[model samples]
Target: MDFKVREVVPHGRNYALLRMMPVKGEMPEVEPGQFVQVEIPNSKSTYLRRPISINWADRREMWLLVRRAGAGTNALCDLPEGSRLSIILPLGRGFDLSVRGNVLLVGGGVGTAPLLMLGKRLVTLGVDVKFLLGARTTSDLLQLELFKQTGETRVTTEDGSMGHRGLVTDHPLLTDGEIDHIACCGPLPMMKAVAAIARSRGISCEVSLENMMACGIGACLCCVEDTVDAGNVCVCKEGPVFNIKRLKW
Candidate 1:
């Protein structure tokens, strides 16, 4: 389907939130944690594509919260409004929404985008969701009020510029036993910490791996991750979201 860039907004210091209008056709039915491969022709060498998480998706339109991490993202950020970009939406498996009990959502840095959308879904389904958003500094934080609208919220920053002076695990949600299910997407170490805490507490938890990719589909072998049960799992095909019990980490 052809998606048109409708609007663009800056998120954090290095990221931008792109709002795109979906074209009429088979709309990509994406879960909260899935992503899309965007084909931008802003540069010559960075051709073919770059993979970006579906950050925040909805029915008619969805927002992509992307940080300008490198060449691909830089090209995307330079796109002007009304530009037509080739994108494959909902290209991968997403978070498991069926287990909608009390959910504690955690995200760090640019990874918090998808969790914001997930929190919204959880609230709509009557599942309680508490958020722990972390960043290195105040400038790294994104979508504060947006997630707050979903449910109760907490925040942490490594430099103590905003919330607690520590990692995301320092947030009350991790130490508090009230959380029923935990869902996380963040830096590897941060996600590991949250996942470990959830495991220790015997709470069901899920983590989305933010792997670098060329194709958002399973065609490329770039996103393969090692697993305990399944030796190799494709983040784009098998899942970007994995249950704590299943992952080797």
Candidate 2:
């Protein structure tokens, strides 16, 4: 689908929060934790569309939190309002919303993007939601105010610039609360550690993987993840989100 940029709000030196709307119709239904493949404009070296998580979506607009990690994302962040973008959206599976009881959503760095929508939906469903966010420093944490509005929010920064002075896995909430479910998205090491903690406690956990991808469709086979059930499965199709048990981690 084609979308037009409505606004570009830069979060820091490396991140931009883009608000967009469809060129011709109302926004389609998008599950939280699903992502979009954005075609980079005016970039010669970038071939594949960049995959970005759906930060939030409403009836008329969609938001993408993009990090300027490379040439493609840099170009995407620099796009002006009113620019047109080609996108394949709402791709990949998302976190399970059927969960109930006390739920914790954990994120690190740019991984915090998708949790905003997830928390909002969970709140509407009357599910108790809390967020545990971590970053290298306070500046690395994005959308704290918005996250707080959706649920109880906590923070951990390696630099100790905010909240707790350690990694999120070290947060007291993880060990202290009556957590019924955990959904996490972050660097592999962070997610793995969080999964381990969840495993040891016998709490249900799900994680979103950030595997490399060429095509956003299963046909490309570039984003295959080794899973316990299906061997090598495409993360773009089978999931970007998976239960910890299904993962070979």
Tell me the whole-model lDDT of each prediction, alpha carbons only. Answer: 0.82, 0.94
Cα error, residue 189 of model 2, in Å, equals: 0.5
lDDT score, candidate 1, position 173: 64
Estimated TM-score per prediction?
A: 0.94, 0.99
Evaluate residue 69 in candidate 2 and report its C-alpha lDDT on the 0 to 100 scale. 93
Give the distance in Å from residue 247's predicted Cα in candidate 1 to where it truly belongs: 1.1
- Residue-by-residue lDDT tens digits, candidate 1, 1-249: 578888888765598988987766535567788888788766776766777787676677878888998888887877798878788767777788876667888899998988987888778888878888899998999988888887888889899988889998876668775877888999899889888888888899999987776676788788888988988878878888889788887
Tell me the tens digit of each residue's lDDT in model 2 across 1-249: 999998999998889999999999898899999999999987899888999999999989999999889999999889999999999988999999999999999999999999999999999999999999999998899999999989899999999999999999999998777899999999999999999999999999999998999898889899999999889999999889999999988
For model 1, what is the C-alpha lDDT against the true structure?
0.82
Ten contiguous residues with the weakest lDDT in model 2: 169-178
Which residue runs of candidate 1 sit more than 4 Å off their true CA positions?
none
